[model samples]
Target: MSAGDLSGRRALVTGAASGIGRACAVRLVEEGAAVVAVDQDADGLAELAKTVDVEQSVVDLSQLNDVDRLDLAVDIVVNNAGLQHVAPIQEFPPDRFSYILRVMLEAPFRIVRGALGHMYAGGWGRVVNISSVHGMVASPYKAAYVAAKHGLEGLSKVIALEGADHGVTSNCVNPAYVRTPLVENQIASQAKAHGITEDEVIERIMLERAALKRLIEPDEVASFVAYLCSDAASSITGSSMRMDGGWTAH
Candidate 1:
């Protein structure tokens, strides 16, 4: 199918307020898809709705009941909502750990489950999980985040296998650290955690972790996600597309 073949199709994106979610929503609309933008930030959702033909919903994805409340039957679901907490396993708060899993893993499961009947009846659908390079490798101070992402990858693969005959494809997009507000805030967060300056956090922490020595852009990840959701990606399922700039190469 052509790049512009998304006309009349509907897509729902979590975390649509900012970062990769915002970029993906914009890109999907540009390719002719009607979008449902979901986020906890009502202000951000309002801004996003003004930019496209989007149905905006303000819901906290960490709550399973919130996922159940979405009533639309869309052609695609992008589970992009997530959180990052930095702490050693010994220092990590149990509540924070639970929150991360609920948002990153449990919520995706619920959203996919809720969309299944609709997708199966329609005979076509796509589920794109916005995972991370941490999903593939280990990182210090990201215990809960990494674990949830890893679980999300495994869950996507299973859905791909189970949904194939029904014409529903499930896959993941794993990108290295991107230059989003989330990552930018990490400069301060990591610096405080490590007792270093923001410059040191960027140079000695983040850049050092990446092979490319550069942070990824949200648009780059968005384009890859948009491609995966397109009809051209029909043959692609149960796979992890790495946009990690070779971070996992080592």
Candidate 2:
């Protein structure tokens, strides 16, 4: 879509402070959408606000009560907030699993639930969920992350089905592994869990499933997100678009 395609549109992007979330926020704004950039990182949001005119919302997604309080009446919602804690299932902490689910799955539900009325009333909306390859498949020592993403995949489809008559679309963008702080931050945890060095975690673990060895850039994923919101993609609802560098081909 061009600059005016999303003119007068308003978008809410969670985890908008950095990484893929930041890229999506910037991309959407470039297309003339008024964006509400939400994240727990105040400094990072300040940095983003320096270059783009997006409303900043500094709130933790893990807090359900706070998530419900967010002004979610918007035309677009990008559910991208996430965290990773690598550990075997037997060793995984219960609280961590709940926390990840809260941010990745439950928070999206709340956001969409709150926004659907406005979208339905306006007869137009887009919900682009930033899911991972793990949403479709499995990986060791990532039970919570995998489960939450899988749940998101299901929720996206449900939203697409229910919102179809109202001119609303919901889809998931599933990337194999993007070069973002979330992936970088997980390296140490992955290394410790797999009993390997950080370098090995990238070389032997992260890239092993994909045919491409290089990590995907944030802009690349963000580009696909923007495409989904374009007029051209109005028919592409309920689909899990995999930008995984052929990772799932195996």
Candidate 3:
């Protein structure tokens, strides 16, 4: 499908309050999809509502019961809600690890489960998971985030395999460090963990593994996601598309 070809499509995007999620919501609306924006931040959702014609749901995704109860009968599902906790495996809190899994892995599973019936009946659907480079590679002090993202990668592939015969496609978009509030918040923690200055965190740490020494823009990732949802990407499923600026190429 061409840009703006989603005239009648319905989409549900989690974490749509800010950053990459917000960009994805805006891009989908521009493509003529009616977007249902979900996030835990009421103020952020309110702000997003002002800019786009979207239905809003303010709920914490880590609440597994609430996640399971969500209305997910949409043509497209973007599982993007996530959080980070910087600590080594031995120092990582058990509850925090569980919470990350709940939000980043289990919630997507629940949402997809709720939406699959509708998608199968309608004969079309898309599942786009916003994962990280950690989903494919390992790093220090990010045990929970890495584990959750890796689990999501597996879940996305399983969905792709199961939905293939039903016209539903499931894939992941893995990005490295993007210019978002999440990364900004991580700067201090990363610096502390690596025993480096904030400047070094960006230069010698974050961008060190990437061939391109720059933070990715949210819109850049969103544009790639938009392409994956189009008819042009019909044959691309069970794949992880990297927007990591060559981080994985190393």
Candidates' lDDT values, in order?
Answer: 0.89, 0.94, 0.92
Model 1, 1-250: lDDT tens digits are 2345788788999999999999999989998888899999999988888887788899998877878999658889999998899888999999999999999999899889888888899889999999999889988889999999999999999999999999999999999888888998888877887999987887787878667878889989888888887778899999999988888887
C-alpha lDDT of residue 157 in model 2: 99
lDDT of 2 by residue, 1-250 (tens): 4434798899999999999999999999999899999999999999999999999999999999999999988999999999888788999999999999999999999999999999999999999999999999998889999999999999999999999999999999999888899888877777987899988998788899898888899999888899999878889999999988889998
Give the TM-score of each candidate.
0.95, 0.95, 0.96
lDDT of 3: 0.92
Better of 2 and 3 by TM-score: 3
The TM-score of candidate 3 is 0.96
Give candidate 2 regions above 4 Å deviation.
1-4, 188-200
lDDT of 1: 0.89
Better of 2 and 3 by lDDT: 2
Q: Clashes in candidate 1: how many?
A: 0
**What is the per-residue lDDT of model 3 for residues 1-250, given as tens digits with 9 covering 90 to 100?**
2444988899999999999999999999999999999999999999998998999998899888888777887999999988999887898899999988999999999999999999999999999999999999999888989999999999999999999999999999999999889998888877887888988999898999999999999999899889989989999999999988999886
Winner by lDDT: 2
The C-alpha RMSD of each candidate to the native structure, in angstroms, is 1.7, 1.6, 1.5
